[model samples]
Target chain A: MAKIRGSIVVDVERCKGCEVCMVTCPTGTIAMAKEVNHKGYFYAFPANPDLCIGCANCAMVCPDGVITVYKTKI
Target chain B: MTEATGIKEIIKPENLVYKRTKIMTDNVLSYCPGCGHGTAHRILAEIIEEEGIQSQTIGISPVGCSVLLYNFLDIDWQEAAHGRAPALATAIKRLLPDKFVFTYQGDGDLAAIGTAETIHACNRGENILIIFINNGIYGMTGGQMAPTTLVGMKSSTSPYGRDVKLMGNPLKMTEIVATLPGTYYVTRQSVHTAANVKKTKKAMRKAIQYQKLNKGTCFIEIVSNCPSNWKMTPVESNKWMEANMFPFYPLGDLKVPAEETTK
Candidate 1:
């Protein structure tokens, strides 16, 4: 069987932790960090990177354009 | 073997599927954490980049929450007085007929003070595009009641929800602008979700395409959210917008050319 491996990089400092990406993510790959950034806002990070599907939904819905998505086939 | 391939290799430029649009400047956006302005700006930038029209595009910034729009995009910009973006855009488009000119306006600017300019520009079928971001309440002024604010919607001015009897009704500016003979294409869209973002990007590209053809004015109303002014979390604001804003201002095209209306 083949699988599409996916990953995402979140610019922790630039993320506003709005959670739009979290709700919009179909695979629940994103989670908000408990610690806040210097801007005093929680930031989003990938909690289940393995679940990512390279959908890029998070980046599209991100208000800050701080997330980048990547994918490969295995 | 698969485990041997590190993430660095998978994330190389060739493997990268999505990244920030080059049209967006390095400046961090001035919008609130969850506000839709950033997404809308990104979508606009992506369209410009994809169409290779970054050099030919001119944007007019409205005096509102998005006044700093020029800072976000790497395009020539003119800051218009409150509600005068359409008028300014008209002049730019007329002078540079070969370029694609557009105005980014808020509901307060487009529907209230600039109502005449907006209406007249569309009426004249100005060879330009008007991008209207309607978030209902006045987000920049700490949540004042805007012309598009929904009835019974609470704002600083309308402490109690808007009273239609006293404050008049929420204006359907998109619908009003669509009826004008000058407008070639008009649509209402949002950027709350990924699908909506894609749809909005398509609409923006189409508007720009129409401008290249020297078609009449193109109007796009973006139903955005104001999390800070709405006194709700970013996610909550989107939910509230979907529940409340959509009913008063439904999404989809308000007008289109006869050629595109076929079976």
Candidate 2:
């Protein structure tokens, strides 16, 4: 079976809300979420999953060390 | 040979109790617990030793938390007035063009009052390396407001969030420094994690290389953690630096213009 490539899955719990990934993302898919976490910290979420090119921009830009990008092979 | 054990096993020619035979103990470091200054100092000492430039290396210690760096770094160091580390470095490098000179400054010292000196030095293409430590706040003066203080960050002066109306915006020194034509290499890195710590060392090494080779100005801004001032545990502050500050001051090389770097 051929692999299916898909979107970035961020662990919001681990996210420190730093927007490095947002700035580096070429596809402009990720956006800061309106909701605050238990720590009262706002985080970035995949706003346009469809627009995500699986470039690992979010992973590369994330300083919180919480983000991981799993590229689904199409 | 018999197997070595305990202190004997650790005690080797390379593992001498004292620092490099060449390093003078006149200068000592003055940083708080969990500060990244020690790590930076070790890296620099190693560079000076490896290059065998201790005799001619002139280190300029700036004002800020690490103001008393002249005490820690064993080389011949000069104390630069508040926010004038670059200027001091420029003067020494110009007078002794054959010598290796570098400046060590903190965010409060580099981004705040020393802005003009730093910009002018880089713009003039001074052949010096700047080891910039950005801990976000003015750590020396009791965690007061600093130009690099992030928004919503609390400090002695900014008890509330860093208001834009009053404090203005946080300065991204590396980004601004990279834009200068004289800058040969500019990188922004952090020492919050083990891997990043290694990267920071690599950047420092390269910055030193640029200076030793007389390429041009090399600016390495290290995004360090200030646990005492930030009022968080070492581990917590490291986490905070990674999550909140790393994004704003993204790590990686900013400028390495081939023309200048080739020289």
Candidate 3:
């Protein structure tokens, strides 16, 4: 069966660490980082990158529109 | 190099799927982290872009949390006094009948300070869109109780939770406007999740489409959350909104233009 490979670029400084995308992701691919960004907020990162399906759920619900998604078929 | 490095190669321009809409400027939003205003602004920009109305759209921003709305979207904007956005929208639309006019207002500005203007605009059936954001508190002004604040819900003025005996019941603005003969379309929506975001986008698209018909007022009430003022994490605020806000301001269309009945 073919699989989808997904990746995302998070603008760390622009991200306000709302974590809205973390709760909104379907495959549990995102998580908050233990290290804070320059703004002292725990930014979101692709914790389970391989599990990403590139549905764009994180980007869709991100209040700041900071996450950009890329996907390919394998 | 590890296999992970090979996977990173897929992050190329060709595979890009989603990016910020060009309609929005690069300015960082002034809204508190996790506030609904950002998402709402994004959705509004997306709708205007999808309709190819960027050059023709004029947004009337109110004097509350989203007072700086003009800085975010790349469109013509007019800043209105507290609770008077609807009045501005009415005049602008009448003067320029061909342009797409909409007002973005919060609960404190709409349901409270601008109630008279809001009612008359809807009552007269002005051909314009009114985007009302109901967060139930004055988020920008230190969380004072708003007209739409839930009964028994706490605010700075009602620290013990809003008491109906003193503060009065929450205003159902959408329902109130739906009854006006001039309001052709009225719907209540939210942007808390993916499904809801999609639904709201559709609702807005229809409202925009109705604009060309010169129909009555198009009012969309977006029941939103204020995480910073509510003192909860962004995710928690959504859950609280679902439990408390949804019960009072249920999501769905209060009215929609008739398919063949209008033309």
Q: What is each predicted model's overall lDDT from 0 to 1?
A: 0.92, 0.74, 0.92
lDDT of 3 by residue, B1-263 (tens): 45488458658899899888999999999998888899999999999988999999999999999999999999999999999999999999999999999999999899999999999999999999999999999998989999999999988999999999998899999999999999999999999898888888888898888888898799999999999888898999999999999999999999887773477
- Candidate 2 segments exceeding 4 Å error: A1-74, B1-29, B259-263
Task: Output the better candidate (1/2) by DockQ.
Answer: 1
In model 3, the number of clashes is 0
> Residue B105, candidate 3: how far off, in angstroms?
0.4
lDDT (10s digit) by residue, model 1, range B1-263:
45336566567777799999999999999989899999999999999999999899999999899999999999999999999998998888888899999999999999999999999999999999999999998988889999999999999999999999999999998999899999999999999999999999999989988998988999999999999999999999999999999988999999988899994
> Candidate 1 — which residues are off by over 4 angstroms?
B1-6
- lDDT comparing candidate 1 with the true structure: 0.92
TM-score of 3: 0.96
Q: State chain A's TM-score for model 2.
A: 0.81
Per-residue lDDT tens digits for candidate 2, residues B21-116, read 234243333455346665566556656777777888899988877777777667788998999999998989999998988999999889989999
